[model samples]
Target: MIQLIASDMDGTLLDADKKLPPQFPALLEELYRRDITLAIASGRSRTALLSLFGDLAEELIFICDNGACVMQPHDAPIFHNLPDQTIRDVLDLCDTMPDTIPVLCGFHHIYFPENADQAVENEIRRFYLDYHKVPYSALYQTKEPILKIALCNMHGTAAYTAPMIQERFGSQYEIPVSGDYWMDLMCKGITKGAAVQDLQKQLGITPAETMTFGDYENDISMMECAEYSYAMANAPEHVQKYAKHIAPANTENGVVRTICEVLGIHMDSLRKSV
Candidate 1:
């Protein structure tokens, strides 16, 4: 029996417009009734996820910052900090890449350069709600350790930024192309898959009893953590290669539809409940 369901947010669970489906709240109720736990795993920060889910955030687990931080419901967050020198090295690299904007992700705050372009800052605000514009040095002085470093390139990260990052830091860190415009860097062993394994061990839920859905390169490791892994139809062909199954596109409420189908919850009944 499936006991846990973990899903990626952007491109997997959220629609093209980045909005949650209207039936999602009701679906959560159904999952709760069946004693199934839901985890939102994403490159997004904890503050962003909390704001997105509001009150319901307290009930769900969050694998945030590309698994650099994991927060269990009602528990303190588990953080994996990047070494101080590593953070400085990445920032130095970003200095050479003018088009890329680096966002330093700490447990309590997201920090970006005060001189970043306004347009880029506006775009980043959508995912990083609790953020500050400060010198990069401030990141090192913070009480909360830096957990992840996210580089954003509105033009496209996969084609440009990601390749450079991979060539320079691939062996030293876990760099995942999180989205068309974003790539994330974390400690070597930190990944969505590792976070899922930790959760499974704590909850006594095995991979065989877990289900996961994702649509990006960063989600690849996570797909391996579940026996019933699903890649959204909209996911790139390469990303889909990691999944065990294919589901409808996120625009079609694929996550909800697949969950109902796998758990034997009738779609008609779900719609009625909504």
Candidate 2:
């Protein structure tokens, strides 16, 4: 019997239009009726996730900034793995590399560059537009510290500069590429898997009682952490390798279908009986 369900926001739970499925909220309601916990784990910032969720915010635990921040809905943050010196160094690097923008993500707020272009705006929209403007210097001066630093390099140069940057910053700073053009730098212990473990412990749930859904490199640890792991059919092969199950694509209501199937909800209208 599953006690918790943790899912990735972007490619697994959200559909092609980047919207949650029409019927999933009801499905989640059903799960909650059964007294199960629901969590949204993503590389997105906590504020962004909350804004997108809007009214539904109260029913979930948010594991944001790729597991760097974790908290209950509409509540003060309970967890953060912020790195002060690393955020400073990453911001300095972005200054040197003018073509790029370093997005500082934390449980408190999202820091943006002075100005951004269409590509950058599109990137921002993808996370539901949850950022505020702050001076680079003031951003680094934060007493709150930083959970993750996202380097937005639409030119796809982060891969090239990333290795050198990691070498310079050493182990405390780690750069992980999620999209083709974007790279995220996080502290050593801050990862999706680590966050899942934290949630599992808090809820008194174990791997056998947890289920997760995801479709990206950042979702890899989540896919590995849960006993009942599922990789969206739309996921890359590398990410799929982490899951024991493969559901249909996001456009096909995979989450709802898979959960309905697992719970034996029998939604014959939504699927062709085999």
Candidate 2, 1-274: lDDT as tens digits: 8888888877788887888877766666777889988889888887788888787778888888887778785667755555576677677877887667788775666777657677876776677355676666676666656678787877774465566566766476545666656677787777888888988887789999998998877788887778899999998898789899998888888887888889787665333322
TM-score, candidate number 2: 0.87
Clashes of each: 0, 0
> What TM-score quantifies how close candidate 1 is to the native fold?
0.95
What are the lDDT scores of the predictions, listed in order? 0.89, 0.77
- Model 2: lDDT to the true structure: 0.77
Which candidate ranks first by lDDT, i.e. highest? 1
- Count backbone clashes in candidate 2: 0
| List of clashing residue pairs for candidate 1 | none
Alpha-carbon RMSD of each model: 1.6, 3.4
lDDT of 1 by residue, 186-272 (tens): 999899989998889999999999999999999999899899999999999999999999999999999999998898888777678
